[model samples]
Target: MLELTNVSSGYGETQVLYDLSVTAKAGRVLAVLGRNGAGKSTTLKTVMGLLPTRSGAISFDGATLPGKPYEVAKAGIGYVPETRDIFPSLTVRENLDLAAKRFEGSDWTIERVVELFPRLGERMSNGGTQLSGGEQQMLAIARALLMNPRLLILDEPTEGLAPVIVQQIHDKLMELKRGGLSMVLVEQNFGFATSLADDVAIVSKGQIVWTGSPAEIRADIEAQHRWLGV
Candidate 1:
C-alpha cells in the first residue's frame, strides 16, 4: 500500500536519508524500528512530505504522494507525528471535527472513534491541553481515525508514556490492526513495534539495515544489538 524507493531527504544542508527503501503492505502493519538519532522519524517526515525528497520515489495506493504535506494528507494518508500535534485549545470533539474528512469517502465517524476509545466520549468537551499524555495520544489517533485514511502513519505513539498507558495504546492499535488498517509505525520501542507489526525493518542512519518478520528479528540478538542496540 505504501512504497518508498531510494528516497533521500534532509532538513536543509545536512542530508539524513540516503537511498532509503521500504514498503508497507495493505491490511498489515510495518514497523520501522531504531534507536534515538537513527533517522526513523526523518523517514516518516519525508514520506509524509514534511521534508522534501531529494531523490527517489514514494507511491501510495498506486499514485505518487505529492511533495507537500497537505497534498499528501489529502491523498488519503493519515499521519500522527511524534509531537502528537494536537490543538491544545481545541476540545476533544473539536479536534476530531477539525480532522474529519469526507472527500475520501470516510468510513469512520465521531461515534466510531469515541466507541474505540471510550475515554474520549467522556471528555468530548474537554480541551486538548486538559488531557494527560496518554489521553492526548488517544486524542491524536482518534482524530486521525476520523479521517478514515487509507494508510495510517504513526511516529512514536508510545513514547514517554507510562507502561500501563503504553499497553493501553498498544491494545487499541492491535484492535485497529485486526480491523485491517494499513499502518507504518516508526517506534523506538522494539518490543511494542514488533508485537503489532506484520513485517519489521530496522533503520540505521536513515537507511533500512534489516528487514524480516518479528520472529526472525527476535531470534537474531546480534543483529538486534548491531542495528538497534537492543
Candidate 2:
C-alpha cells in the first residue's frame, strides 16, 4: 500500500536518512526496529511528508504522493507520532469530530472506532487533558482511525506507557490487522514489534541494515546484535 524508493531526508544540514527504501503492504504490519537515534522516526516523518525527501520517490496505491502533509493524508495514510497529540481542550467527541475524512466507500467510522475502543466511548464528554496517558494514546489511535486511512503509520506507539496499557494497545492493533488494515509501526519494544509484524527492517545510522521476517530476526542473534545493539 506504501512504497519508498531510495528516499533520503533530514533536518536542515543534518541528514537522518540515506537511500532508505521500504514497503508496507496491504493488510500487513511492517515493523521498523532500531535503538535510539537510529532514524526510525525520521523515516516515518519523511513518509508522512513532515520532512521532505531529498531524493527518490514515495507512492501510495500506485500514485505519487506530493511532499505535503495534507496531500499525504488526502491520499489515505494516517500518522500517529510518538507524542500522544490531541487537542487538549477539546472533548473526546469533539476531537474525533474534527478528524472526519470520509471518502466515498471508506469503512471506518467514528462509531466503529468507539466500538473497537470502548474506553473512548465512555469518555466522550471528557476533555483530552482529563484522560490518563493511556486513554490519550487510545484517543490518538481512535482519532487516526476516524480518518478512514488505508495505511496507518505509527511512531513508537508503546514508547512510554505502562505494560498493561501496552498490552491493551497491542491487542487493539492485532484486531485492526485482522480486519485487514495496513500499518507501518516504528516500535522500540522488540518482542511486541516482532510478534505483530509480518516483515522486519532494522535501521542504523539512517540506513536499513537488515530486512527479514520476524522469525528470522529472532533466529539470527548475530544480526540482532549487529544492527539493533540488543
Candidate 3:
C-alpha cells in the first residue's frame, strides 16, 4: 500500500536518510526498528511529506504523493506523531469532529473509536490539556481512526506510556491489523513490534540494513545488537 524507493532526506545541510527503500503492503504491519538517531522518524516524516526528500520517490495506493503534507494526508495516509499532536484547547468531541471532515468510508467513525478507547467517551467534553498522556494518546489514535485512512503511520505510539497503556494500544493495533488496516509502525519496543508485525525492517545509520520476518529478526541476535544497540 505504501512504497519508498531510494529516498534520501534530512534537515538543511545534513542528510539523515541514505537511499532508504521500504514498503508497507496492504493488510500487513511493517515494523521499523532502530535506536535513537537512526533516522527512523525521519523516514516517516519523509513519507508524510513533512520533510523534503532530497532524492527518490514515495508512492501510496498506486499514486506518487505530492511533496506536501496536506496532499499526502489527502491521499489516504494518516500520521500519528511522537508528540500526540492533540489540540490542547479543543475538547475531545471537537477534536474528533475536526477529524470527521476527512472521513471517506464507513470503516471508521467516532462510535468505533469510542468503542476502542472508552476513556475518550467519558472525556468527550474535556480539552486536550485535561487528558493524561495515555488519554491523549488514545485521543490522537482515535482522531486518526475517525479519518478512515487506508494507511496509518504511527511514530513511536507507545513511547513514554505506562506498560498497561502500551499494551492497550498494542491490542488496538492488532485489532486494526486483523480488520485489514495497513500500518507502518516506528517502534522501539521489540516485544510490541514482534506482537503486531508481519515483517521487520532493521535500520541503522539512516538506511535499512535488514528486512525480514519478525521471527527472522528475533533469531538474529548479532544483527539486533549491532544495529539496534540492544
Candidate 4:
C-alpha cells in the first residue's frame, strides 16, 4: 500500500503539483488519469524521490519513503518511467541481469518474466535499441519485476504502441494483477487503464479532482469531458 498526502512538488520555482493526494491499496491497481501537464508523472517522481517532496508526506507500507531513488527501490518499490529508460547499448539479457535482485520468498525470476514475456525470451541477445516500442515496454516491465517489488509504479505503459501490442501489454498486466501485485499506474490509454485498475483518481492542474471506481468514471460523461477531456 502507498499513500501520498497533501504532497506538493515541482521544478525549481515552477510548482506543478499542489496539495495532491492519492492512494494505492494492497494487491489492487490505482490508475491516475489526467490530461497532459496535469502533473500525473510529477506525482510518481516525487514518490520515487527523483524530485524532492517540496511539501507533505509520502508513505509506503506504513513507513515514510526514503529520500533517494535507489533507497526507494530497495524499499520494495519499482518504477517504470514513461520513457522506458533502458540501456540502449546493452543486450536484453544484460539489461535484465543488471536489475535482478532476489530475496527470501521472492516469486519473480528471469525464467518467470521470460514466461510472461515470450517475445523478450526470443530477443534475449538483442540490443535495447533494436527492439520495437512494445518490446521496449515489455523489457522495462520485465526489469522492474526482477527487482521483486511489493508495489510497482508504472508511468504510461501503453503509450505510443500499436493497438495489438497494447492488448498484449494489457493481458500481461492482467496476469500480474491476478498474481496479486500492487500497482500504481499513470496512463493515457483510458480503456486499457480502466480495464485493469481497481480505482481511479483523476488529476487536474496537479491535484486529484475525483476518486472513484473504474465503472463510475466510465459512466460519468460530464466528469470525463470536464476533467479528462474525453
C-alpha TM-score for every candidate: 0.97, 0.96, 0.97, 0.97
lDDT of 2 at 202: 92
Better model by TM-score, 2 or 3? 3
- Specify the poorest-scoring 10-residue window by lDDT in model 1: 97-106
Q: What is the lDDT of residue 149 in candidate 4?
A: 94
**In model 1, which residue pairs have backbone atoms overlapping below 3 Å?**
none
Candidate of highest lDDT:
4
What is the lDDT, from 0 to 100, of the residue 143 in candidate 3?
Answer: 88
lDDT of 3 by residue, 156-189 (tens): 9998999999989998899899989999999999
By summed lDDT, which 10 consecutive residues of candidate 4 come out lowest?
A: 99-108
Residue 7 of model 4: what lDDT? 95
Residue-wise C-alpha lDDT for candidate 1, range 1-230, written one tens digit per residue: 89999999998899999999999999999999987888899999998888999999999888888999888878888999899999999999888888774433478888889899999999999998899999999999988887778899999999899999999999999999999899999988888998999999988898899999999999999998898888
Model 2 segments beyond 4 Å from truth?
Answer: 101-105
Q: Model 4 residue 209 lDDT?
A: 98
Write candidate 4's Cα lDDT for 1-230 as tens digits.
Answer: 79999999999899999999888999999999999999999999999999999999999999999999999998999999999999999999999888874433457788889999999999999999999999999999999998899999999999999999999999999999999999999999899999999999999999999999999999999999999899
Worst 10 residues of 2 by lDDT: 100-109
Model 1 misplacement above 4 A: 101-105
